[model samples]
Structure formats: structure tokens, C-alpha cells
Target: MVSKLKSANASAAGQITSRSPRQIAWRRFRRNKVGMVSAGISIVVLMLSLFAPVVCKILGINPDELNLDLIDSSGIPTLPNGGISWEHPLGLTPGIGRDLLANLLYGSRISFLVAFLTTGLAIFIGLIVGIVGGYFRGRIDDYLGRFTDFLLAFPAFFMIVALSEPMVARIQETGIAQGNGARVIFLIFFLSFFGWPGFSRLVRSQVLSLRERDFVTAAQAMGASRKRIIFKELMPNLWAPVIVVVSLSLPGYLAAEAVFSFLGIGIQPPATTWGILLDNARRFVTVYPNFFLITAGSLVLVVLAFNLVGDALRDALDPRSER
Candidate 1:
């Protein structure tokens, strides 16, 4: 009986020890009901956006193709006169007569793409700068710190606004950044350019505190290469904070893209982003409020879902939290 008990205890202990940190973290995240729900909604939104082309094909609707026959003499969709049909369930735009549902799905793809790419680029730059600067801790640190301070003081929004027209003109002349694709690339560049400073500073501060820890010191004393020590030892410990920062910042990036588009400097017309849709619908607010409401509602839903998920992630990843 004693031998059997020992064998069972060892098996359980082995299983417990084999579980990875990510598995444990996932378990903790799943226990948070709000977080799980938000994550599910976010995933659904992303999947819909990604598969929008397939959805549009199945629905037999073209987002960019205009149906002038559906418009009245005043160039507005006849949706207000009970013209909504199964073919265009979301009705049609007043001036363009483009399918609202198709536009929404495709627009969501652009929004998600811009947000994800900008966030990824910003994180990459910030991680490199922060890790290198914090690890070196000398003149290199001083230079990077000063650069970061300068970026923090810079007025990114106004700069983008002032330069957008001229930059677009230049890009057009280059024959490289054409049409909506150019605009999308430009917005991604502008947003990511301004997005990294806060993350870099946060990472630098964390690295400063962590570099002096016993494990890092032991790694150094044991003659580990700088690259190995930084990546293998320090990087693993940084994941918790990095993950929190990424979750929190993704919503901000998405909102920034919308704001830029609203101001007319983002993805231009014929490319229907949520911001563009909102701007186009604003003029017909009283005439057809559904257009404005639908776009705005989607924007709010995505942002709210991201914020909720971020909050839940922060709480779950916090070591001090008892959950």
C-alpha cells in the first residue's frame, strides 16, 4: 500500500511540474468570465473581418460596386421608403449606393490590419531599443534615453496632419504608394512611428530593475554571451509585462487609425474604413441615422471589447492578484 501511494504521488508531481507557464497563464485567463467573453467576441470579429471576401461572395454583394439604379433623383438610396431587401440587409449608402454590410466587413479588415501591424511594429522597435539600452547602461543608455525624451516631447498628431498632403503628393510622384494601399501603408508608418516611445520607456524601466537580479547576475558571472543573457534569460521574464502592454495599446492604435481617417488624411474614399463611413454618413444624420449608428456602434464594440480584455489580462497576469 505504501509503495502504491508513493508511485501515485510521483506521477502527480511529474504532471504538475511539466505544465508550462503559458498553460498556467491560459488556465488563469479562462477562469475570468468577462475576459473569456471579450476574447471570444474579439476573435469572432477578427474572423469575420478576415473572411470578409468569402462572406461577400456568398452574399453576392460587392462593397465597392455602386448601384445607381437603387438611388433616387437626389442621389440618395431609397432605403427610407421601405426599399431595404434581403439582398442588402443593412440598406445602402445615400450618395454611393454601395452595400453597407459589405463595406462594413471589408472596412473592419482594414481597421484590424492597421491596428495589428502598427502594434506589432511598435513592439518590435520598443523591445530592441529598451533591451539594448537597459542592458548597456552607459553612454548608449544616455543617448537612447535622450532620444526617447525627445520623442515624448514631439507633437506627433499635428506633424502628421501638416505633412500628410505633401507626403502623399511625394509618394504619388514616386509611383509606389498608389491608391488606398499607399494610404494604408502611410497610416501604419505614421502611427507606429509615434507609438513606440511609451512602450520602450516601460520596457527600459523594467529591464533596469531586472538586470540587477540574482539570475541575471549569475548568468553574467557564468560567462553567458550578452545576446544569450538578454534574449534567453531576460526576455522570458519580460513576457508578462510585454503582454499587458500589448493588450492595452492595441485599442489605442485602432482608435488612432479611425481618427486619422475621420480627418480625411487616412485611407481615402472607395476604401471605406469605419472612420470614412462615419464621415460620409455624418451629413445625412437626420435623414438616415442608421448609417451613422451602425458604423459608430461597430467602432464602440471593438474598442470596448479590447479594453475589457486588456483589463482582464492585466488582472490575471498580476502576480499579486489572488484569483
Candidate 2:
């Protein structure tokens, strides 16, 4: 009997050392072809954005410093010397004469910042509203539900248009030193204001279902506080859905930024974003088609990567999977 008990203890110890939820999720993600490809794209893009300064240094180009000499001369959008130097393959812009590649890499930093901030802010606001509304299904829920409906009633683009002018004006008046930093913050705010409702609705639906689950009931029976149950137990269980939503939200946020810029409301002069780059290419698409192709291609890749990864995460993280 003692030997059997010892054997059982050893077995339990071995099981305890097995892969965790995160490890399992990672393994599953790696096994997925689309997920792996998406992850690769995400890593490359993030690295390019993060190390823009280093890349600029290695290329002997100041990302912010403009060279007017190359402006409008445009043979192939290459180097300052006008030869097909491998340094600036995309060529220099007309006004700034900055290396397109360098500007692209640098611009990604701001674009990524806006996308991430917008998604995070939306998620946070959604979580708060969702938890409160879902855990308590009464007057509070009704009020919040109605408020969410009101937010949803407006077309996202129209809402952004209406808000951008006043918000941008306020940021300009703040005197906190204008330029890239200010623009990024304001864009994030704009995206968040229009973006949060979708996430809130998602979370609310998930929480409404989760609140009735057995574990939740057990926690309630064990005298767990509503706060603890909602934040700790309930929220943690919603990780699968949250991961999927966040992954999807990122690309949507990026697209929104691009649209705003395309409409002349986003990243402005002296500060370049992928959207602004695309906007610039729009006028010259017939003349300089490469410009449009490169810019549009990059944006498409980013959006597609996010969507593929989000779908993969949803499948891999599902608790009911036949693991």
C-alpha cells in the first residue's frame, strides 16, 4: 500500500511538471502554418520599427534630416548622388529628399505606437464596462448597454471626422511642443474613442456566458467577493477570447489610422506614417507606380498577418480543442 501511494505521488509530481497553458498555446501556435508566418511578419516589422535608429545609422542617413537637393529629380528614388545606389532603393521623396526606406522604418515606430495604444486603451475600457455590466445584470447593465448602443450608432469614420478637428486644435493649443509625439497621442485618442465599443460588446457577451459557469458558481459558494470573482477568476478564464480580440483589434486599429491619414486627418507633414506614405503615392500612382505598390503592399501584409494570427490563436487557445 505504501509503495502504491509513493508511486501515485511520483506520478502526480511528473504531471505537475507538464506544459502550462502558455506553453501549450505557444506550441500550438508554432504548429500552425499561418500563425507561424504571421508571427514571422510581426517579428520582422516590430524589429524594423524598434531598430530604425540603428538602421538609419548604419545606412549613414539621418531619418529626420532632409536633403532638398534630391527633391523632384526622381529617376528611381535612389541615393542623393542620383545613381542606382543600393542604399535608397525606393528613392527620395520630392520635398524632404529623405531615404524612403529609412523614413518607412522610422515611420513604423509611430504607426505601431498608435496601433498598440489604441488597441490597449480600447481593451481596458471594454474590460471595465464589460465586467460591470455582465457580472451585474440589472439597472447598471441596462445603462451601460444603452450607452454602448449609443456609441455604436455612429459610423466610426464619421465619428472620427467630427472629433478630429476639435481634438487636434486642442492638442495644438496645448503648447506642449507640437510634432510627431503630439500627433501620435491624438491619433491614439481618436482611435480609442471610436474603437472601444466593439471590444466592450465582445467582453460583455463572454462575461455573460462565463458568469453562469460551474467554477464561477463554486467561487460564489465559497464566499469569493464579486470583485475577486470577476477580475481574478472570471477574467482569467476569458484569456482565450481576449487574445483573439486583441490580435484582431491591432490590424483594425492600423487600418483606421491609415484611413484617417488618407483623409488628411492623421500623421501630418514632417512626420511620416505608412498611411501618409500611401496617401503620397496615390497622386503619383500613374507616374510612379512602384511607390504605390510598395506602400500598399506593406500595409496589406501587416493587416493580413494580424488577421491570420488572430484566427490561429482562436483555434489554438480554445479550451474544447481535442488536445
Candidate 3:
């Protein structure tokens, strides 16, 4: 009876183990109502943005064109509720006179693009710095830790804002990128510069824990090169945290872009973003509150959706939680 019980337990364990982490995470994520809803919202927003050009075509509106006629002499939309009408469902942007719906769709694409690029670059730098510092202890690690501390301690946000124009100008002078592209390039660089340290520290801690495992010791014993051991034996284990952080931090990066744009330092003129819209609508809040509400509400909705998705991911990937 005891032997039979042991065999059954082992079989059960094997069956449970056979399900991959990804499968388990996905199952858990699917069961979360808030997560599922958030994911749906995120997908819809992304899809809308991805097909923005087509949507604009169907709407018979061009986001880039300025409709001066729609704006009255006072820089407010001619129609009531900030120009909300059948032709312009979300309304015309007050003063600017662009299709609000079209700008929103196009803006999401730009915001997401900047977030992704910044996240990718930051994570790449963090991974390399983390792996080196964690794998090789002592002086190298100490120096890196100090530098990371220094970066974290600095007033990097203001620095980024101050640096924006100069960097954009420098980039333009190089003739590498012009107009919105130059500002975008500079924004990505500065954002990544500020974003990497926290992630690197997280990775370093995880690496420290992992390097002490039996596999790493065995690899060291087998005359494995440092590069091979780090790459082969360690990197595979870092994906869970990476994914979690990326999901969580992406929203922050997106919000950062908006902040800079609101301050008139991000993406520059001729580029309509959530931030730009918010900035434009701010002055008209007393008379035309609807414009501000719509602009701000859209940003809040997307940010909130992304945040919930991130939460769901973190919960699903938590090792201590069987669910």
C-alpha cells in the first residue's frame, strides 16, 4: 500500500511539472477578470492605433491636416461641446482644429513605439551591466553599484528636460534625423539613461541568487568559459522577472513621454500625442471642459489598462503562488 501510494504521488508530481511555466501563467492570467478586461482594452487600443491610417481613411479625416475653418476666432471649436458631431465623433481639437479621434489613434502608436524602444534599450543595458556585476564580484561589482547609486541619486528628470533641446539640436546637426525623428531619438536616449539602474539592480540580485546554484558550480567545475556559463547557464532563468518588469515599466515610460510632451519638450510640433493634446486643452478647461476631459480620460484609461495588465503578469508569474 505504501509503495503504491508513493508511485501515485510521483506520477501526479510529474504530470503537474509537465505543464510549462508559460502555460501555467497563461492559465492564471486568463482567470483574472480585471486582467482579462485590461488585456482586452489594451489589445483594442493597440489594434486601433495599428490600423489608424485605415480608420482615418474610413472616417474621411486626415490627422495631419489643420482645419482652420473648424476653429472660431477665439481659438475654440465652432460646434458645441468642443466640436463633437457626427462627422467628428470625438470632436475637433480646440484651437488646433485637427480630428481628435484621429490624433488619439495616431498618438497611441507613437507613445507605444517610444515606450517599446526605450524599454528595449534600457533592458539590454541593464542585462549586460547586471550580468557582469553579478557574475564577477568584488571591485567590479562595487564600482558598478556605486555608479548605479550615483545615477539614482541624481535629479535625472530635470536633467532630461534641460538636455532635450540641446540634444535634439545636436542630433539634427549630425543630419542623422530631422523634425520629429530627432526629438524622438533624443527622448529615447535620455529615458533609457534614467530607466536602467533599477532593472539592473533587480537583475543583479536575481543573478546573485542564481549563480550559487548547483548548475553554475558544475559549469565552473567543467572548465566552461565565463561567457558560456553566464550566457547558457544563467540567462535562461532571467526571463520571468524581465517580462514582469517590462510590462510594469512600459506604462511608466509611456507616461513619461506624455509628460515631456505636455512640457513642450517631447516629440516637438506637428506631432500630435496624448500629452500635446492635454497641454492644448488645459487652457480651455474653463470654457470647454469637454476637450480636456476627453484628452485626459483617454490617457488615464490606457495607462490604467496597462498597469492592470502589469499587475496580472506579476501575479501570474509569482513563484510562491500556485495559481
Top lDDT hit? 3
Per-residue accuracy of model 1 over 63-119 as CA lDDT, tens digit each:
988888888876678756424678887878878688888999999888889999999
Kindly report which residue stretches of model 1 are placed more than 4 angstroms away from their true locations once superposed. 1-19, 80-84
Q: What lDDT tens digits, residue by residue, belong to model 3 across residues 41-155?
A: 9899889989999989998877887889989888888877777787888988878798899999998888889999999999999998998899898999999999999999978
Identify the superior model by lDDT, candidate 1 or candidate 2: 1
- Residue pairs in candidate 3 whose N, alpha carbon or C atoms collide under 3 angstroms: none
Show model 3 residue runs off by greater than 4 Å. Answer: 1-17
Every model: Cα RMSD to truth: 2.3, 3.7, 3.2
lDDT of all predictions: 0.86, 0.80, 0.89
TM-score of 1: 0.91
How many backbone overlaps does candidate 2 show?
A: 2
Which residue runs of candidate 2 sit more than 4 Å off their true CA positions?
1-19, 65-84, 174-182, 320-323
Question: Model 2 over residues 1-323: C-alpha lDDT tens digits?
Answer: 99999999999998886788888988887889978899789888889789999878887766676667555554334444332257666666544566777778887787888899989998899888988898898999999999999988888777777777777777878976466556677888767877788788888898899999999999999999998998788888777777898999999888888877778888786678888888888876776676677778888998999899898898789767753
Model 2 RMSD, rounded to 1 decimal:
3.7
